[model samples]
Target: MPVLPQVLALLFVVTWGVGAALLTSVSQLSPSGYDFIIIGGGTAGSVLANRLSENPQTKVLVIEAGIRLVSHLKSIPVPDMTCNSSEDIQDVKIPFLATSLPSTSVDWNFTTTDQTGLNNRSIKLARGFVLGGSSSINFMTWNRCSNDYWDSLATASNDSIWTWPAVEYYYLRTSTLVPPSDGHNTTGQIIPEVHGQDGPVQVSLPGHATELDQRVVDSAFILGGRFTYNEDFNAGKSIGLGYVQNAIGNGTRSSAATGYLLPIVDRCNVDVIISTRVTKISGSLSASEIDTVEIAQSANGTPTKIKAKKEVLLSAGVMGTPQLLSLSGIGPKGVLSDLGIDVIVDAPAVGANLVDHPLVANYFTVNSNNTWDPILRNSTLFADVLEDWEIKRQGLFVDTPGNTQGYFKLPTYPGGVDPSTGPLSANTEVIFANGFAPFGPMSFPDSGSYMSVLAAVVSPTSRGTVIINSTDPFAAPVIDLGILSTEFDIVAMIQVIKDIQTIVATSPWEGYVTGIYGDLANATTDDELTEFIRNNAVTVNHAVGTAKIGEVVDSHLNVIGVSGLRVIDASILHTIPECHPQAIVYTVAERMAALIKHQYGI
Candidate 1:
């Protein structure tokens, strides 16, 4: 069982007097309308607020459901383990803190319906309820999709603006690249022309990567057949091994709230309110536009109506955005009717086309001294490392653990690895981390160390749904990821597992691992490997496509059949990108800002 904390102590843990003071209280807010009322002050919402509020003439009001807390710099732990407590503040300025578990107080903690594809097991889906959203809680790997994917997005929506050549500018404009540590990448890993230097978000390599990370990269080279080192994965083609670029700088997490909003909190035109959930969107059906957003708490305990003059932008993320739409009578008519809610728009695609990356891994026993598991197991070592992290932000504490990542395609496999629906993007990703398996229980040898090579199926043919459980706006939605719900995806996962085994058996990477887990290392056939995957498959937490473009929204991200509304978050992604969606989401928000500015002539 989990322990509870003192409520009073939590509420006052840190004073956000700097930025939180500028926020409006429910009672303090006047009934005055703003030019834009953005719901969910999350990853993309923070960006939207910063860019949209740049117009001195426009007033932007952002309502976030989570409260603010001062962050403490903490050391990184083994992957998938919870490190930060409710009292622990999340630093918006820190980028390496992505692997921390979903903070209970701030995380929506949604779970999927029993997956028929995966033995009827439900998976936990974590979404940040805080001001910065999942960007505040996600691993900050700075990677983008292949140009081909973005080009297809343009074609899908019948809009040239979504093309790679046009949208690529926003990708550059959103991030300021910081080169890796001088000592580690002396051979030059980053390509200068590919990144921007004056953007809001900060992107850089880990301060120092482990020897194991380098060995894994070297092993890719040892494979010698289309397995060469990629100097930079962000150059539109990421299909090889390399050091991962992160969103960390100055030894802290640089979330959208810190990068975009923290710097300009004094702007009088922008008003932010925390711990206030938007329950429903109310407007006249005849106008085909939104007029006001109803909040959980009114000034006098009744529902409060915050009006939007220009538009109501929904940056509420993949799950929350669609739930709010359904609640506000903007989703499928059948779903709304079942919940006893009148349908504003009978859009069937509103909660459909869910996508996510499903992952499974093989564990290996290594030298105790080579891996960092010992540090986490010993209290004294953990304390020392945590102290070092709090003070200097160096050593094992600063490592993003999985700072080394590899991407490859499995084209020719036993049961067909090609995506049944989408383009031929790389179907597999191997993340070499400095710990044991990212998920599941481990049976460690008495003294030997352990590390994990997580292989995730990035290009999955499986589609899921994010439907509202009931009309209750506060209830969690029914998220059915339907992972491995397709035959191609299943075969692809099995093939990737075999490929990882082959890679680890090579020179440099093989030298580190003393032994491998029996189920994979001993299995001789693909069917055995497939069965292991069926039992151990887990999500990489890369959920997207629930409310995607070309289906729910058009090129501009405006919810189809509606006016004065737009979705500017991961939910709008046509498909989950080949890489992490943080950087891509930033690009999407940037492009949306430009589009909104041009459309309304702001």
Candidate 2:
């Protein structure tokens, strides 16, 4: 239901010239073509390309499956999200337009297999098929998880390198805090010391002001106990409501491509090619080596073999990583054998342990006309707001869905058997939107302005799979998110829903909130609430732990049986973090890049 993108795209076309985006690929590669070949030129791959090519002696090649938008996109901090080749001009750059990107041309358009827990329904999963991967398409909430959540990785992997301090060093080095585009003073909005001063990605608080901003913040003071105000959740203590921070600056989206890849794409030792899919990764598994990659343009296109002298980095995200490995004969023995694939490593964990947060959203009528529904319904007001963003770099367009957010621990974790790692770990998450939140299948109300409240089970114990159904690389993988499969997750969600009900009952929202809309209103008992949850919940797309550490990959992220090959990206997270996994992925890539450099004495 996002407007202004299709309208404003023409304005940008007149402002900046338009043409077909660059589409170039390597038809032939020599034995010593490059020192490293990175598959999927995405979030982690862009970071690897930037860091590895820093040394003049090293050579790097990035293979991206999506088309590049512009030749010199890095020169501008916020480039047009869509071009002649893509749809929704504001989908990537404009923060408020995050909801518009999911089913667009840049999205992967993946649908999960029918889940037994979700009332036998399949949910659509949106991952970025564009240059920057999911980082380009995700709702840009930026925050590192708790200390024990990180230390738990060290315990699981049994490696000191995964410790909190070591990860924190790279975490602080991945992004820098920046002033909001609207020039609003951030006095107590965030803790400045907790963020980095100089880094590739730019992070900032919300740029534009919202009507529900003060009320959302004041709920902590008004409610008194569980709704305490948190100065900053990124400071190793994420427990209460706080101002939302995002990966944005100057009213522009700062993704891995705009921050790392595009800036250094013209380097002498760095090369990039697009619209090319890495079909199969074949090499000697017994010798702990993987050096060759087969790539093709289409399902019927013949694949060409490309050799790598040093290593082959698998930065192909959660689903794609497991799909590639299984196609290359490194997965469960029975699954591969049934598909006529010769089993090599017998890694049963390649596509297992998938974890993602299951979220539920509700809308309520508010007393104000400032919400986006009215503007979206009116062309004049929508254009006026768009003009404000174009002229002053400040407006509703600069704000994301979360104007203020809350993170909390469950009052009574199921049976006192908590899945969270420590005190800082969060069991519930809430996103307070000033306007109608974009999730699930629901149209805006006929007449009233509304506020959308979203609640999610962050500390979910349910797991799922992402496995290859065939040997064809062009085929989509079979993904099952296994949401609400456990009693722990269901119980936590039931309590969280009640907490949201209590928070809205405060004095601040007396006239504002009318009541809950949809099927959520009819639920009163535990049985009814569970039925509504199973019929309504959808994923927030914080998926991690497919090719997890200590199982499919070692502590260093290398495929256990394959040497000179590493699986970088969200797939390596063994246990999902309570916060959004985007920040953690960046921190992991930064840390891993440093180790990869030291190993080669760079």
Local lDDT at 312 for model 1: 93
Report residue 490 deviation for candidate 1 (angstroms). Answer: 1.2
> Clashes in each model (backbone N, CA, C under 3 Å)?
7, 1
Provide TM-scores for the models: 0.91, 0.94
Candidate 2, 1-602: lDDT as tens digits: 43333243222311112221223645433335789889987889989999999997898888888756432111111222211123433346767767767766677878898889989998888888888888887888997988988999999889989889878889988899999888888988898999999999999999878877888778888875667888888999778888999999888778888888767755767777778899999884443468888888888888888777788999999989999999998898889999999887899999999999999886777888788777765656766776676677788888786778898888886678879878888998999888776576565554677788888999899999998878889999999888899999999899889888888898878888988877888999999999998988888888899999999999998898877789999999978899988888888889999999999888
Candidate 1: pairs in clash: 93-252, 93-253, 94-252, 94-253, 94-254, 95-252, 95-253
Model 1 per-residue lDDT tens digits across residues 1-602? 01221111111122345543346477656456689888988888988999998887878888887765345433422222433334334443334345454645557777788887777777677778676787777777888777877877787788999888998889888888765533355355678688888999888877766767668677777875545688888887877788788887656666787788776678878888888888988775553577778897432446777778889999888898889989988888998998898887888888788899888867887765857666645656655655566667666656566778877777575454455223435678888877663453234333447778888888888999989868777777888888888877887788788777787778776557788864667666877777777777777778888777888888888888878888888888777788888888888888998888888788
| TM-score (C-alpha) between model 2 and the true structure | 0.94
lDDT of 1 at 24: 49
